[model samples]
Target: MLISAEGRTYRQEAVAAAVIGYRFGASKVRVSIEAWLPDNRRRDVDNLLKAPLDALCHAGIYEDDSQIVELSIRRAGLDKANPRLEITLEAA
Candidate 1:
């Protein structure tokens, strides 16, 4: 099965983020994810919208904020064997 995920899973980074939020007394910390949907940039797929959220675990966490994030006129990691999808996270 194929799947896509977005999280600051690195143990140290996640821990540090939590620590910072705690220090600031953020009761309801905001975990925001800014991501690019896809870059099939071939000019042939207009409705090529992908549900990258369906591939994410925290899809419902911010359902009321925004549904998805998308990138345009750009392509990432066309040379690597396994490319990573980047999603920005701001916790707190």
Candidate 2:
């Protein structure tokens, strides 16, 4: 998702943070985000899909390789106070 804030458009990585779990369901569904940084260390966003998610996905993504699966990558925006970059795998 693309977001324009303070006269500037910012990108962000979005992920499912908490999957809705049934009281008796065997497994729950969840959304996750994977953000890659220049340092090689990756940032992961999970269990929380928020308004910033799309922005998040747009923020950090850098490279993607498509073959058997589609991949969208970005930088890392793990911190809520401030975000840097983030990536995501699109829903089929």
Candidate 3:
């Protein structure tokens, strides 16, 4: 699939963030994501999953995205000043 310029940038940043003292082996894991939107515009939380997950995998956070046995995502609220995603991974 084609990733837009913004998406690519986001993935790069995500990978950089994941590589900072964060690493996981080939194990089942749970992922939780808290999304803060830049605006209150309508959006689907599910739409926010792929890029970061893919970025983490690219960063070798785990063996693969399939190793994510459990996943959860929620909108923490709007952060007009700084919209972002807070992702956490742990053994399942």
Could you say which candidate leads in lDDT? Answer: 3
Tens digits of per-residue lDDT for model 2 on 1-92?
34357313322112222222112122221234444334434434342233344433333321211211333333443454544434233333
> Mind giving the per-residue lDDT tens digits that candidate 1 earns over 1-92?
44324333433334443343322122222333333334434543223224333223223323332433333323333434444334343333
Residue 15 CA error for candidate 3 (Å)? 1.2
Per-residue lDDT of 31 in model 3: 96
Query: CA lDDT, every prediction?
Result: 0.34, 0.33, 0.88
Rank candidates by TM-score, best first.
Answer: 3, 1, 2
* Per-candidate RMSD, Å: 9.0, 13.9, 1.2
Q: Of the pair 1 and 3, which is ahead by TM-score?
A: 3
lDDT against true structure, model 1: 0.34
lDDT of 2 at 56: 33
Model 3 Cα lDDT, one tens digit per residue, 22-92 = 57789899999999999978998999998888888888899798899999999999899999999888888
Question: What's each prediction's TM-score?
Answer: 0.29, 0.22, 0.91
Worst 10 residues of 3 by lDDT: 15-24
lDDT of 2: 0.33
